[model samples]
Target: MSERDADSDDPGDDAEELAWETTGTEIDYTCPGFDVRRDDVVLPNGTETGFHYVEEPQAVVILPLTPDGEVVLIEEWRQAVGRVNRGLPAGSAEPDDDDLDAVARRELAEETGYEAGSLRQLFTIEPANGLLNSVHHFYLARDCEPTAEQDLDFNESIRVSLAEYDDLLSDVLDGEIRDGRTVTGITRYELADRWQ
Candidate 1:
């Protein structure tokens, strides 16, 4: 096993102590969707900046690795992200969903027309700091049971695809999989190596 920094967020912080300090305390701003905050800080180079931040919700993603080592990934045309990329079956944790597992199963079926026999928590990712605070959760769902129903987004021109277990790693390493949540899910699946 490779030893990594305990705090992945502050990896660069160890290289040099922040030769700066926050002159102004963090102040919250009333906002919709996600709240924003500002902090006046002096940089290590002695420059001041207003560190504006935002709050985001926790997201859920599913890695449906079939018994044959084929992984279930979704290809959706995301307007916000501005690209049609491949990713694991994923969705947000909406309030009153009541059943996270059910939500996961529903998303899997809706996005890819596949249902899961079982689910397992794998890992999470924090993609940004400036204006996003989202926990991208990963899970493994195997032995999926496909359904006849397809309820994808209206503008979602999604095409489900599969990648072999071995090729999966290479694709991720070569930056072929650019979606952050999906990348985290793949790495999580590799970490335990449960399917192989």
Candidate 2:
């Protein structure tokens, strides 16, 4: 069923039936960018258990398009993966950032030195809900142009490049682009017309 229909008064919908009740929550660990949260919950069957997840601030990912229709991409060193990963410009929202569009613009400028002439939100998604409490706000940035030098964070190592949209899509499909946000952003942009 469609998500909207399922959210309505659907006779067979069992959302509440399988829901778990959270009795309490605690922070198991704290870090600069994320925290480990543990929730004490009662399952549908009345079994008590603890669920752990990584809680983080919302993030923004930009699919930047130059006036020539090329996509701005970033190649960055990923310590977790032990290799450089290619992806769209993305960053977590800072505590002082109140506007998502501003965050998107900031990240794009910081990572790639590109500024968007026009920016529009495409969609939001939980890239990994089962293990992480995170929301990714996806944006489509058009007419992007390099206007400044990259102002990367202390720990960041990024290189910016432009690629044809078709080539980026091909990389995603051929399993060369494994970054989830980049893949999702590219696919969403491709399917945006049908969704609208």
Candidate 3:
């Protein structure tokens, strides 16, 4: 049964279903990181609309937890925002990356100079589902230890630090950790058992 008509037990369930039909699409712009596109879609009410959206590549974020239960975070300058932002180690998938976990591990090592003893995925999230088409794969890297010097890109400048898990959660709830993906990761880790 269609979800819109499930509660009513109506015979015309198919008629009550809401959907949008994409009649046409055009690429407005294409760049290295993302592409902007416009879709011509007809709504359930038969109204035609032009929806502009961004198609971004998939990305990954990792929270590296040390043996003492400290969470590894990165302090980096965001050129787009013109300010220093604190967040988990994260990066988009490179062309050679096999999967999201590869991207996550590479980002974690590159940004924090640590290797995870045991890495496990927490969840995948779509922080900007309305405007951007991308997924942020979140992982928990426990028992992390420094292995090598950070290998950052020329455009990247990052400082790494470890904070207590509770303290990180406090910062997240107190508006200190403002990055949306980082917030999602921390909240997911903090509330995992509760959700299960």
Show the colliding residue pairs in model 3.
none
Give the per-residue lDDT digits (tens) of candidate 2, residues 1-196: 0012234334565677977888888899997889998889999999999998888888999999999999999999999999999999999998788999999999999999999999999898878878887889999999999997899999999999899989999999899999999989888778774246
Better model by lDDT, 2 or 3? 2
Lowest summed lDDT over 10 consecutive residues: which window, candidate 3? 1-10
Q: Which stretches of candidate 1 lie over 4 Å from their true place?
A: 1-54, 193-196
Model 1: weakest 10-residue lDDT segment is 1-10
Looking at candidate 2, the ten consecutive residues that score lowest on lDDT are: 1-10
Estimate, for each residue in 1-196, the C-alpha lDDT of model 3 and write its tens digit.
Answer: 0011234334565744675778888889997778898889899989999998887777888988999889889999999888999989998886667777777778889889998899888887777867877777888898999996799988898999889888989999999888888888888887883245
lDDT ranking from best candidate downward: 2, 3, 1
Q: On lDDT, who's better, 1 or 2? A: 2
* lDDT tens per residue, model 1, 1-196: 0112246556465656653466775438664335566668789888888776665445678888776768878888877889888877777666566666777777788888887878877766766743565656677888876653668765568898888866877888789988877777677677765656
TM-score of each: 0.68, 0.90, 0.84
